[model samples]
Target: MKKMTAMVMALVMAAGMTACGNVNETSSNVGAKIENTAEVQTTDEQTEETQNSEGAEMSGIDGGWIIPDEIDMDKNPEARAAIEKTFVKMMDAEYEPVALLGKQVVAGTNYCILCKVTSLYNHTRQNYAVVYVYEDLEGKAEITDTMDITLGNTENGYAETGAENIEGGWSISDEIALDKHPEASAALEKARETLVGAEYEPVALLGTQAVAGTNYCLLCKVTAVWVEQPTYVLVYVYEDLEGNAEITYTTDFTLGDADEEYSETGEEKMEMPNPWVEYSTAEEAGREAGLAFNVPEKLGEKSIYLIQAFDGLAEVRYGTEDNEISYRKGREVDDISGDHNDYNENSAMEIDDMTIYLRGNDGKVFGAVWNDDEYSYSYYAANGVSMETAQADITALINENK
Candidate 1:
């Protein structure tokens, strides 16, 4: 990651969006540049460039960064001593060194250590971060920068599943719909009344986690008071049982070129976090899960896009995040997709000599579950539909002849 890249990009691009939370990607020096002088400077520098004087042409490396043969902390005591001297408790994030990634030699030594970051707010969620520690000729060590290594969800942006997170952690999932969640909408409005400087348009209701109170993570399209081009931010809000809500935190991210790309595609896109589920294709998922599954030519006459995964079990998704057909397949276990939500309607359809049970609200069908002697399977439609549509879709999935 480029240190001070944001500092330079902010001035270059006129940083339309900035946040009050942790700026994780390379914010070392803000106002000063690390010069080429022989002086052993130890403070965070402002320059985006990592300049190496003698090590430039040593290994066909054009970026002025070098990789030494030995980087073990035990082998290189400097690495161990440097972290001990520089590692400090952060406000929102804390880092534990995993290994020395690499190093750069400038006026002082800059070391990049791979670290496991524990969220101070939600201790249950942990992710990787690259920590940059600068050690000077005087043997003084100080942290210069940190870059979080987070991936985005395929449906939304990057993050693990909402089903996996606890309180204080951000669950960047596309499963929760903002339009369907009145509580999140209410909490956002409650917090928005207090936010005076920026305009936030809700993009996605990531999910809700409960600690002492309930925490809601939202993906919002942000525009400063100046109508200064829209940007994206993940806004965290806390709601008490009494319905009192307040903004807890905000972090900015970019998923693609522009915000309209999502609106145009008709997907409830999140900022650049990976889907909570592992992203893989139908064929790849079948290989990983050790089961051969078929894709429908047209599920209920809807030309759906299929993306499936093997996260403990097979999770197959069809259609967009808004109106999806969720299909799950695995060995020897079944319950209303593991959730306690009950549909008012339930029925059974005999297809290909297998009894496919269906469930939904009112007289429509939104859920279906069945099992062979070998495995259990389920299919759910986000928006309820006619029982024939569910049966047709199930037939298309199971019987290639249909």
Candidate 2:
């Protein structure tokens, strides 16, 4: 469960990165740099100074690696070099590279470099690199470079796949074998059995429901009942070119110890101890906590059950009951931002007991809620404009300043 929670948190963080204008650039040199190009005006530190002065900023989660204003390029010729050095120390590991992909771009408000690396010797480490440089009207270069190596479930971005647990700490299979197998000793053997038979899929990339990657297979355990809606046990399955398979199982049911009324008098119902720790059958209410099981109605019978998985190393249950805001098919919205084109349109709403913004057809955003009948957008536009509008104004100001 801890592993699943971590994975979900990582995905949430990644979503934040995308929403924050993440520019996924690639670089061949995990930490190396091109030399003798353009004018040699000042060192990399000076370059960082120039870039910082010019207003180039990097977000907190730059794929988990932060490029300081200045890099010790002499220590490592490229960003990849630096990344390798840092990774070895961080992961306490050694790796033999199996594959590498690189790219470069030129002539735009920003220039970028991106890279992806795969190592056969280690299954836990998946590495990526990025370098971004942009110029303002003044032509001052603002640069940002990062090399991040995410641990846990490394999959080839191609078809359905599963990650192998190497030295770096991708925790997909450890718990299943160590804790779930009959007295824990049957873990690996069970994984081999399940994985060899299951199909793998690449983790989803561009959507809210996007799983960590498109390369890992969602392993389903056939344990009784229907082949259709609402009943299934899913595990993550993966294999190497050698045909070795691994499976990590998870549960998506919320179990409640007791059903109690909300303590609060208002519409916003709140409860404590969350009896629904793992799952709830009621679609209109309840949630999938973390605990799950595989019980056979009879021997050799196959059944289907819903299973939820995440991208990071932790487990997280969907919020259920009170506020009962379940986003099943719709895109989950976050970091709500937009231009304040109109004042009256920007408001808030309460939808299905959950607080959500009622975005207009015109793209203006408002806070609103669903009253089971229609939307009631809030009209508290402050003494000033909304944050979205304020950001737009700031951008205009920056351009004007430029």
Candidate 3:
């Protein structure tokens, strides 16, 4: 559940950041000369400017802070001095500037600078420093606030947060109308069938955005069965560039009363026989009923009963206090086509060339029905027990009998 909660938060944050316009913009600091040795390709306009501009200013700021070429030292002397003074104070406390991530002018005289820095004493961890520079009453630029934030503790580090605060590239956009993205509708239907074992119409695309780091991300809302209530659930779908999509996360929130409680349909329930008679083995019970029986070793503390018998078929039941498994076999019941619809096609398993089907609702082993030219056999286990254990036991029974 903690993992589920974290997944929900991630989806929400992904969508939320898109709505807030935090995608990174390449043009924010157009004239800034980045000292980073990492080669980054810029657009044609940037390339033209780089060729025309002369060598940038290389002096003035102490504490080894690299002054961005965009920060015109001659034009904004006051602002340059203020940032240098602040950087020096930071260095005195052992924090050294490592990289100038970005810089942008917010208003008439206010500017924001984002940087990556490291503690000189503790070189292991990295931190983000946001410096806000504003013009004072006398029109002299001064440092207003410097907030240093630690990074890399959470699953999504500065990448997620940076995407949440920056503006422009590959971020979540507005809520995509269902008509605009027709493929999202089909994806929602598939998600409902897989998660709730029922069909549901999606309400809308809650949000759509291409992740800054990942290829694609989408969040949508659909009505689904949560507990016994019909609720709105957020489904997060992720896709690679190749268009392979997977439902990666879901968050449930109650909506209102449902028309009816969700339940598995089509299964016919039978009453327990009044006079329960015990049988030692399948052979003994089948012999009395004039039929052939193949039974495996009794599992757990089970009691075998000759539950019922008719003209061409018989039912033998093995049960513990809370779990029960039934085996029905006969020559005339060779055509089990009528009961085939109740099985989940997606949950098929092949053992010894026999195909077994599970219940669609809860993934429990519904039963296995097969004919061997002479006779037919069907095995089913009650719901609420471990399907894995039941399948294993059923497989053993079938292997031993066949």
Candidate 4:
């Protein structure tokens, strides 16, 4: 569960002064020439001179940062192509070319372009960055600089934004609408399902890392089960390229006075998010998966049941603490149960006109699979329950739904 991506882009970027050639910060003291890059905004007051120019001309003043009269980067092919080609290998952020902010004629052409930054995993938050691309005479493009735009005060003093504060190459996202991003929200819901012993009320999305897919850092308020004592923790959720998302780790994060609570839906007794549509109670899971399965009374009231249904398959689990019995059923003629753990012994029996194949070590039947006239059914008991006991469990499982 502790899967963290290994990346070096942030490291190279941090050592930008020495990592590569031409990024020597020797082009022309940009920080000194511009005086203050943070105050440069492409507003109506600043773009007045270029408003009358042709082809979206640069507003560069005497080899310094230019407040362009017009941006419209879609109309600038070179800038767009440079950004696409240069950032093609970058997995940290998704950059969309916004406008050509300015240009400086140096040893090579330095094009300053404005871009909207978004996480590949979540696209609900709005972030902006200014990217500097250095194009040589040979037409090879490389990123010389990048600055995350903060509306008020700049954090890194007009230098590259993603390098300094990076921990494991995880770049912090700007302020977002906490509970809005669909993917992050879905990820939190799934992670919440794994938090069986505590109450984790979500606070905000802290940051993210782009790897094979994405990893999200979420701030949550965790109340230890039965203690009523609440504290803060940073929850990390990893989502793979194939859409399999899970909580990777949870570490204590002290927020001090910065922690906040997201808006509540005012729902009572809601242990799961979107209960009917996902892992939920028996009825909801059955309706969603389109399979009407039953929970046997034999499992007892103390049993903890988790149900989930989807296209072609419906699955349920009955368990208490460490002992679990998983049930799966579907109309498709395949092993809907994903477990393939080999059992040393195997036997067969006839139950309700269907053949049940029981498998276990030396005869303690821990697994059973069968096919009724209409559907394939499977169950796994990892608790070392006996054949007779499993038969009774299976009988109760079939008898109630019929």
Which number leads on TM-score?
A: 4
Model 4 residue-pair collision total: 0
List TM-scores for all candidates, in order.
0.32, 0.21, 0.27, 0.33
Task: List candidate 2 segments past 4 Å from native.
Answer: 1-222, 225-230, 254-381, 384-401
Worst 10 residues of 2 by lDDT: 35-44
Error of 1 at 351 (Å): 1.8
TM-score between candidate 3 and the true structure: 0.27
Please, what are the lDDT tens digits per residue for candidate 3 over residues 146-219?
A: 44332212223222321232222333223334566677665544433433222234443533444532222232
Worst 10 residues of 4 by lDDT: 256-265
Residue 261 lDDT (model 2): 27
Model 1, residue 379: C-alpha shift (Å): 0.9
- Candidate 1 weakest ten by summed lDDT: 33-42
lDDT of 4 by residue, 62-105 (tens): 32333334446656777777667674323324667766755555
lDDT value for candidate 3?
A: 0.40
Tens-digit lDDT track for model 1 on 223-290? 55332234345566667777777665454532111122221111221222222345446666656656
The residue-level lDDT of candidate 2 at 170 comes to: 37
Clashing pairs in 3: 22-166, 23-167, 23-168
